[model samples]
Target: MRPLTNTPTRYSWATILLHWLIALIFIGQLVLGFVMVRIESQRAAFELIQLHKSFGFLLLGLIILRIAWRLGNKAPPLPPSVGALERRTAPLAHLALYAFQLALPLSGWALVSVSTLEIPSMPFNLFVMPNLPLIESDAAEGFWAAVHWYLAYAGAALVALHVAAALRHHFLLRDQVLTRMITPSSAGE
Candidate 1:
């Protein structure tokens, strides 16, 4: 079996898998969020919203695992070709990505908790997930809903920036930044 740990020159298979999975799911969740909001029928909208909530909870778990894995493994170093400014900023950018990965779901969960509707989230329809113990208030619900919405947009922007940076590293800089994540070499640097 392939080792699941990262090396100095390339990310482990685990990291690669988690990264892509989160990216795909996040994109799908964004599309679902927009589509569900536009759903005209109340029943259809409720079902879609429930699905969205399930996926959001799933994302929360995946991200928590990813973060734990990342902390335990030493990530590959930035290529020597990378600039000083980029090197300094890259960690901050990553921190922001992790922050959003966490914040978005928690905010959504909180929003559901304080909502007057009081819908229970069943992740993947496996079982009922308890809501956060937040006081039921219209004002609180609105606040968390707004927070969730804004955070989603902000996270989307960060993802776009991340993709642009990766493309720049791949096409413009001709570096290993993008390749390392996609297809890490077995040979050590």
Candidate 2:
């Protein structure tokens, strides 16, 4: 059985779980966001938008926990096959991912908060989530909406690059970069 914490060569089960869960939800949010805007039915679009907001809040919470966990735990090192330049840039790339992951949802939250419609965000109908204490006006709403839209697209591009890098490490480099994330480290065994 794999350990709950990170191993020298493998990720902890918790890390693996959070990684995939966030990835899936983020991807779903992107798809839902695009489709919801283009929806012809007002009711359908509103429903989807609510769902998207709920998922965004959920993502926000999970990411907070993920960041906490990551800070507490040390990551496994890259294999020797990786070049020095890649090694240097990998941390920056990861930092960018973390930043985007945090920023995208916050932007969405800001967008909803400043919306002139004054819609209350009830995440999964659990409770009414309060909006950020930002001024509410059409201009504020439009600004945040633009920020959210641009961030979403930019974050998607970063995610694509991240995936390509992982695939390159796995297929071309023939290294354990991807597998370590997929499975537990075999350091002890």
Give me the candidate number with maximum TM-score.
2
Looking at candidate 2, what is the lDDT of residue 131?
A: 93
Report each candidate's C-alpha RMSD, comma-separated, in the order given: 1.2, 1.0
Superposed by TM-score, candidate 2 places the C-alpha of residue 83 at a distance from the truth, in angstroms, of 0.5
lDDT of 1 at 154: 98
lDDT string for model 1 (55-93, tens) is 999999999999999999988899999999999999999
Residue 36 lDDT in model 1?
A: 96
Listed in order, each prediction's TM-score against the native is 0.96, 0.98
Task: Judge candidate 1 against the unseen true structure and give its global Cα lDDT, from 0 to 1.
Answer: 0.92
Model 2: residue 51 alpha-carbon error in angstroms: 0.3
Worst 10 residues of 2 by lDDT: 180-189
- Model 2 CA lDDT for position 30: 93
Clashing residue pairs in candidate 2 (N, C-alpha, C atoms within 3 angstroms): 10-185
Candidate 1 displacement at residue 118 in angstroms: 1.4
